[model samples]
Target chain A: MGDTFRDEELLADVICRLIGDVRHVAVGAQSPIPATAALLAQARGGGSPYVSLLGSRAHTFFTDGARELFDCAGQGRVDVFFLSGGQIDSEGNINLVSVGDYAHPKARFPGSFGSAYLYYVVPKVILFRTEHSRRTLVPKVDFVSAPGGSPGNVYRSGGPIGLVTNRCLFDFDRARRRFRLASVHPGHGVAEVIDNTGFDFDRPTHVPVTPAPSAETLALLRTTVAPMLAEVYPEFVKRVFNVPAPSP
Target chain B: MPLIAQSLDEALAPIAGGRLLAVPRESSGVAMAATRALIRRGIKRLHLVTLPTSSLQADLLIGAGCIETLETSAVSLGEFGPAPRFVAAILSGAIKMRDATCPALHAQLQAAEKGVPFMPLRGLLGSDVLAHRPDWKTIDNPFGNNDPIVLLPALTPDVALFHAPMADRAGNVFIGTQRELVVMAHAAQRTIVTVEKIHDGDLLRDPRLAAGTLAGFYVEAIAVSPRGAWPLPLPDHYGIDAAHMAEYARLAATPEGFAQYLDRYVYEKRAA
Candidate 1:
């Protein structure tokens, strides 16, 4: 993987840019792309933003157990966090519970972990879903594990800043409670996104293609970030980066 | 003195049928040995409360028909894929599911530890999780103007169970950085533990060991079962058995396969 980058790498680069210059970034379990992005951000920022990868001994700073992550988020120490859903609506509502009815239904995803709370507390909660289609980006979510926007009376410090998918990138306007098409990824166009999307979104006359990862970023990811990621996500690194698993 | 049981069954005697049993997350020491014993004994109607989330442990119990109610943040097999049993149970309405976010579970347990009726949490203002949970309430912040926050009722389980690296004869358990065990012990009516080994010396007497030690006062019983958290990691002690987990995910996909798995791994007594 010399000059060219995989879709995962491109997604990671985009998420890393979304992470920006935060004080701390927390990546949850089963999120290899977001984890890669956080690590990349840390490498680029010279370790300014503390990266906490849950279930990794080396990456996390919290010694107070699983609860510490939530407590730290509550205190406003965590700046960036990632959340995904089985179904996401145009308004930014995410559903992680079930597909059809609450009592009885069709498909059922894993229950919400910390999205109900973390989506409200973490300053920049980036919504990410690898699958971008009518099935995932629905007109309305069956259940709101966490809402994209809350009323004024509710205490909310943070919410979805934007949503990134394999097809395109969309920026969420909190006040307007809608998503605007930012740009389509390489080899993808505005019509493809609109055709696949379940809900309507605003797009300019000319939507640019998402930028690919730079050579410097790809080099850093392959050399430095790949090794660090192997600690938590061995299989992902092995498959994506072609790095062999170390002998136990 | 710690009530050191001779066998895993006796160590789990207090966790009777229909009792509320609280367990820790996967990375934290999971009492897999004891869980198997419970299944072998045909334990039923247990209201299982995962401190925050769980994986294979919960899946096995649910598949075995041991759980009547499950209160947890989420249950997944991590990299292995979706927890097949858990998903099936929810879709079939096999058990009562009380969906909660991660922090809400922690706050409720903290409330019980402090002997409070309820604890105020920041989120869950508009989610369906709050709507489904009739017990949880939203209250205006008396301290602030027009501020509303969710209140979670204190959750005190009948017993808290887990596995640890070691425990002293005096019953003090060394949990290292897994401080959530301490919280579970504080909130539960009784705490039962299985250890890989029993240290000869008193755990609380040593300054180095004392900080990470859960005093015998909270631990009701202890049993020695090496590799008690097998298939799951014991943090510093061992890494997860990925191959075994993948096998389990494949085998536990259907009811017949799950029963077959139980017969092979759970019911049989294999040498460690």
Candidate 2:
């Protein structure tokens, strides 16, 4: 486990564990990490589900779960959706629209493809970020691109159930409706999670390790997802996950 | 040959066979009303552009006839299977699939909008799609012996129906960019424009707003409807009606249920 817990590895570990042992999970397009994780889990024979999303149709995965996004509310099949944040409010509201104004936006972030509907509708939503700091963790989202926390809690008015950063895994408390430090990736600690947050949280004494993929999972991830990414996003895959042999 | 302006019965007068008519996804207000009016007049064929989120406005479109066709890409279905009629079309080979993943299809549409005869694109090189879809073909570079470029012939429709924010008496209109209405305008032989309100000016207001986007010269008849693409989505107007769309999901899930819903909303109802 000493491959220097890279960002892609961290994402894969967090996503695989998040799904636990479900048979089906759907993601969106433009999400590279989650796409890899689902493929990795399925390929590794870890009792994990297939990762079906846009563009990953019949080509990437053994089975396609792309249809889950459209009927997320009506059919209710998808287990997770990956999202990002430009601005987030205290109530778990997110805004991917613009940092400044709606009409004449300053930084007009790509408007949510289906993030708004998916965030509110999907049963399980995950907010992921590479950097974990006060700047990234805002007091509130300027736009409600996707809900991190919705009223009535998930299942009724659903929002993000989990957040995974390079540092740790964060899960919102169902009753209190505030993000509580759930676990940290291996080699990381509670202090790291707390230091990165903008808001206060009831810090757990021992923030557990966001589990890593088993040896079998590692092999499958390398073989299945790596090959798929190499086939599809060849350049991005090499640049992001390029891990040279560890120096002495 | 009647020039029906802002009227459903007038626009769809030719195709009142209760078959579905293809329309863009983001139409609203008067455009939606006119579509509804056409449905009431017994034009059953309704083809909606399916996106990821539900095209809730399609509920109104459903009432038009029997929702005989639902044409869209894989991304549009979200979680469920393809719409029933669309599925039937695929199996029966009546409605040809333009596999959205194929860049050739987009280029073809783009070429049509640009008033071109054909368009060249990539990604269909190693695929078996072109061979199956007789409409598409891959030809050698007429210039040199380098490589082949896949081409999609321009697709010109019989009529293009669009909902705009405003239009004048002459049918010159302005549609905010949300719907990509310009593509619809160019790809059709005849264009039907529905306006929310008829402004006094030429409807462009200023050349700055015009931007060569909406070509009034392309439009055929101008219809006026207040809420054409209702409960669906608009450019700068409103978001989709999730609740209404959910009801449609319920209706669309089953064959009998969808037909019954159509009867209550479309068949028995009088023109608005």
Candidate 3:
């Protein structure tokens, strides 16, 4: 929001809408935004039945005895899963592990956690990326950690369904399992979205601009949440949000 | 006690036979030393919990084939013998991956630690991946009459092991981050702990640092080795020895190789 609703509002709106009436979600390691979103949802009265968290980094608050966020994938217990990727294939598969080979590679990307089991097991796979660049939206993934569409003309389920980037939000056609253009965040256009993706897909008449964040939501997030996180992870305040550390 | 050798072979003398060993990735002194012992003992199956430093050590073990990795997500792919590091060596069929934030996973693990069966999540339905996965079966909602419900199976582990920055001789562990470690301890049947230095009243001083998910009775054994969890955890008293880790990673390739490496380092090099 350049001048409109604040960034926090936007985040809150996206999450509130995403977690509608579903129960049980499986989350992985290296997840901060998703965790924040889920915690925010619970804080805001959208109570989820259970949660499953991944990632092995142990901290007092980060790793304190949390488990059973979901049943298995199908039980409707685990519906929402969040992850980020270094590369995304046209078919919606993500690659975070490596670039060229296993032993030695050009650049070593983060590997997929539960991408094999949970991606195959969980119900809904939601992807979040910071920026939508061609480097990110690729024609083909260097490695297919999780298969999206089967070979030619094969029907499939349980693959990536949605991708939410800083620029736009997209959903795939269940049949062909190809990305069909959806809404682009406000002030952004279909052109910007297209320029970011590596491959071509069906074009919508016009992509809707994402709604601006509300004012009330912004105050709570900035006044409360940001301050708390900053106290613990000052670096997060500086890097991820690009804001200077406030008085703590 | 056969001279009470400090070698892993001698230290890990008590536990009965179980293939899969689960532990957190953080650099807890006890688990770290025990993992070192396990590596030295040639324990084959290893399931790791999330720790900031576990990924690096997990890679070292994977490269060595000392443990068959149960779960893995690559953060940075480094070089291994001919193969690239962080590659998903196990290429199974694809599944619908639930995208969760790090914090969310922590909460879920908490729920598991508490022994509650399931929790409901909002906002992930209608995802392409969620619609897939073989285990998920659809059933018509009895109340709604037509709408379908997505059902999931339960996931449980054999063991949960973790490292604590500090612990007592009686096995009270202390931690800084209240991550999902408590949940992991509760979720598993038996837990093994390793610590950096055992003090008399540290955990009791700050009970908040302990994962109350399970009482002290749940812990099977506690090992107190300073700098036990290196790299992942650089306890205030100690720091990570990068050269030692690099050499250790290189040497810990096989049971025989580890034995030879141990003979040089743990066995003949130093007397416990």
Query: In model 3, where do residues sit more than 4 Å from their true spots?
Result: A1-12, A24-26, A46-74, A101-105, A149-159, A227-234, A238-248, B1-23, B27-53, B56-71, B75-161, B165-193, B196-221, B225-272
TM-scores of all models? Answer: 0.98, 0.49, 0.57
Clashing pairs in 1: none
Best by TM-score: 1
lDDT of 2 by residue, B87-123 (tens): 3333444433333321233344457778889976432
lDDT: worst 10-residue window of model 2 chain A: A59-68
Docking level of model 2: incorrect
Residue B33 displacement (Å), model 2: 3.0
DockQ (0 to 1) for model 1: 0.79
Candidate 2 interface RMSD (Å) = 22.4
lDDT of 3: 0.51
* Number of clashing residue pairs, candidate 2: 38
Least well predicted 10-residue stretch by lDDT in candidate 3 chain A = A56-65
Residue-by-residue lDDT tens digits, candidate 3, A56-149: 2312222422333323443444667776677887787777555665334455455444464445445567777766899888898776556664
Q: Cα miss at A190, model 2 (Å)?
A: 26
Question: Model 3: per-residue lDDT, tens digit, B78-148?
Answer: 21121122233322111112222222234344446666654333222333223433443445555555444
lDDT of each: 0.92, 0.54, 0.51
lDDT of 1 by residue, A131-246 (tens): 99999999999999999999998888999999999998999999999999998998788888999999988888888889899999999999999999987777789989999764
State the DockQ of every prediction: 0.79, 0.03, 0.14
